[model samples]
Target: MNYTELKARHRSERENYASNALSLRLHRALSWLNKAEQVEDDDSKFIFLWIAFNSAYAQESGQKHYDTERERYIAFIERLVSLDSEKKLYNLVWSQYSSNIRSILNNQFILADYWRFQSGDIKENAWIEAKNKAMKAAHTALAHNDTTTVLSIILSRLYVLRNQIMHGGATYGSGANRQQLADCSALMFDIVPLFIELMMAGQHQVWGDAAYPLIEH
Candidate 1:
């Protein structure tokens, strides 16, 4: 239906699913995504999309020293990848979205440059190295530490951009900043639905039969 009607329906759905932190966060993210879609200005779209990304990313990253719904989701992804049943899905996601992920990571220019310098350059392995550096920065930036493996750098970079904009270090409209906003908006357009799907999967994995029911009253 129309944007207003869709938003109202989503709000109702969110109210039904607000029993847990994860559900609440998912609904909030979706609401922001809807707003992002409706906004006319690139800057406004960027902010709403960033908010959407941040809401989902926070749920996925969780807090240090605590078992989170995201942890369970990761575990589930690991299992699926190992079993080959979900390998194609994972591969598809990576192949389709990895470039946008890298774009977001590179927006954290200082961190990205440092990682590139330290990692050394191999022309053939540029993508691999970029992924490595992005992962490193994601862990450092988000978890405030180091990680050998990259889990969610894509989402983490969005978080980084959100911080830059929210902290007033970066302007949202015009010139280079405008392009940055555009890039993030495009990336969010691709990933927001995926993030929502992942969160829904996590909810099911963590809550089993009691997972948030998907129905309308």
Candidate 2:
């Protein structure tokens, strides 16, 4: 569902059933998703969309040690995919964004290891071999109808792009990586909404407490 429909549905049905944690997550994520829809600049749009994704998946950790942000989100994706009996996510991965996903996977410029090696941080060009392996694995997963694996790999690539923009690694409005930014932003436009929808549908599952939930003083 689009942002409008999703917002209405949340008010009419989901808000009543959502746990305190899920309610906070959906509200924060949906607000960002709506903001992204009004944005025209690809760079800004991508940033807003990524915030929505982060809002949807971020959780509070009471322990001193916890899963890395990457691991947590990957696990979140696995759960969402498992709950998707309608195969909405599978269809989106296999049919809607396959070519764009391939483009992202093949772009070594976005890979952190590629830059690390170039900067003399590492002696070997291991990222090349790693990238190649990831590409092959992604293609194989696609062929085998393994949507979970495909989505995970695609998310990893997108995470790299996100870091580049958010961490001041990329120039604003530069032509160098315009295509990559556009492609990533477009895919996020679809994926973030679907994620929020799936979270609402699967509210019965434990999503953990949201980080920094609202509290009345």
Candidate 3:
């Protein structure tokens, strides 16, 4: 295809991908939220945010090296809403998508607060700045450069899924990725408890003069 045709095709693909992914993420997020409410562990919720944040960050890297990628998303969304008055779908998509994005930022905010409480050196403003990064990443994906926009759109779609688990009503054994989502949700519940045990073990080793074994001994 010619350059113009190629760009058009590419733009179409990205739009569809973002829509589908955002829809799926909403479903997943809702399920997880349901599960988290029933559970007694706070760590599970935190870990879900952390792992999802990492996942979102990983996907966004695709936009970093591209150009004119961000514009396509803006144009596409504008055109879509203009063509359809079906605000419900748009709201659903945007709510689920933006919510997922915000959840990671929220997670970071919470973690930064905890770290501050524990005497870590993070400043409150610094944490907000760090959280803003995800937004910047999304905006970067929506840049005028077509290439970067495409990549960022995909990353944004992925987070739509992550958001479902964090803020949406999610639950165990509900609809999930079967690998990443299902496994991650299960694993999230266990990580904090597991970490506490590890810390305890390390403390024992320190007192016993175990020499703080080289790596995770």
Ranking by lDDT: 2, 1, 3
Error of 3 at 180 (Å): 16
Q: lDDT by residue for model 1 over 1-217, one digit each (tens)?
A: 2335544654555544525565666666778888888888777887887677556545333233337544544543343334343334354345544565456566544233433554574343565566576656654543432111233455444444565677786765656566556666776665455555544544433322222334558
Candidate 2 residue-wise lDDT at 190: 84
C-alpha lDDT of all candidate models, in order = 0.53, 0.84, 0.37
User: Is 1 or 2 the stronger prediction by lDDT?
Assistant: 2
Ranking by TM-score: 2, 1, 3
Q: TM-score: which is higher, 1 or 2?
A: 2
My TM-score estimates for the predictions, one after another, are 0.54, 0.92, 0.24
Model 3 per-residue lDDT tens digits across residues 102-194: 443345323334345446576667656655665565555434333333324333433434554567535644533334443334433332222
- Candidate 2 stretches with Cα past 4 Å from truth are 63-65, 122-125
Q: Which ten residues in a row have the lowest lDDT in candidate 3?
A: 204-213
Candidate 1 Cα misplacement greater than 4 A, ranges: 1-20, 57-92, 97-151, 205-217
Number of the top candidate by TM-score?
2
Question: Whole-model lDDT for model 3 versus the true structure?
Answer: 0.37
